[model samples]
Target: MIKDELRRGIIHENPILVLALGLCPSLAVSTSLQNGFGMGMAATFVLACSNVIISSMRRIIPDKVRIPCFIVVIAAFVTMVQLIMKAYLPALDKQLGIFVPLIVVNCIILGRAEAFASKNSISKSLVDGIVIGLGFTFSLCILSIIREILGSNKLLGLKFFPGYEPMTIFILAPGGFFTIAFVMAVVRYLGNRRKGA
Candidate 1:
């Protein structure tokens, strides 16, 4: 059962590539590997922690006010992550900018809180958060890698192909859209092939 859930989160129902949730940060932070990685980790931490807390308090939270309650819980976690990042990883904090605080409003987090965590067991919710976060992280990393390599001619700030002129456009907003569309096309092809088989 857990295996199925993990698979669903990571591949079948990926928040970014499949479900298309949380695209704002995904596009905005994926210009570089560092930004994407840092943003992803921050989001993962908040998602996992929020899921556990919300799941535990599911019964006590009033249904009418659960949305606000979830927001408060998620905001607390986001603030904690922001402080820790500012203290320990200031460079990354600056790189991610307002996106970290914006995690409190990420659809994926709140969607999972309302759709899964509130109705699931603590352990299952935890697993769901982790795997879904992993999916988001993986998607971000992949997009960042492509963008970095094409836009900056480097990976993780390391120049691989010397003398290679980078394409400035690939690092821009249009680049993010193009990269996502390409990935989605590939995913669709694979899904269709699997269904046909």
Candidate 2:
């Protein structure tokens, strides 16, 4: 049922935290809440639109060439978001930088198209896309929250722990690695425990 797919997308098969599909942007843009939210929005838009398109054209698309078609559709959506963000959300557009364009290569988008959208109805595919996208967003936001808080001693630019010296390294590339890995471990461990029970 749709509910099952939705649940799986968020936790059982989480794009960022569990499956580790879109780590590049998850790490790169998660230094701040604004950047994390922007990246999540862009990715969600692309995933939702692309899933619908792919579901509609599923029967016509040849399996051998489906990968390229999915990429084209995903890229088109990505470009649309990039243009809109550049014009409207210029600050976030600048913060995301090359990663926005690089979203075309994100495995989560293509994986969904191949794994779900191609076989499911348009509505189901759309829901799956949104659920999975939100899951990815949730993971990124959690990681960014921790990184932003510890690295800068602030949450959404408000200093929460006054007098606490921020760990400057947590905002850097190495910090992203550690933060994501640690978060992934926790998610995986919890998921396994739940499954075992």
TM-score of 2: 0.88
Instruction: Estimate the TM-score for candidate 1.
Output: 0.91
- lDDT, candidate 1, equals 0.90
Candidate 1 residue-wise lDDT, 1-197, digit = tens: 87887788778989999999998878888999988887888788788889999999999999999999999989888888789889998887788767888788889999999999999999989998998998888889999999999999999999968899999899999999999999988998999999999
What would the per-residue lDDT of candidate 2 be over residues 30-139, giving only the tens digit for each residue?
99886787678778878888999999999999999988888888888888888998999888778776778867988888999999999999998899889999888888
Model 2 whole-model lDDT (C-alpha atoms): 0.87
**How many pairs in model 2 have backbone atoms within 3 A of each other, for residues 3 or more apart or on separate chains, i.e. clashes?**
0
Error of 1 at 145 (Å): 0.7
Q: Could you tell me the lDDT of residue 174 within candidate 1?
A: 95
Model 2 worst lDDT window (10 residues): 91-100
Location of the lowest summed lDDT over 10 successive residues in candidate 1: 92-101
Candidate 1, backbone clash total: 0
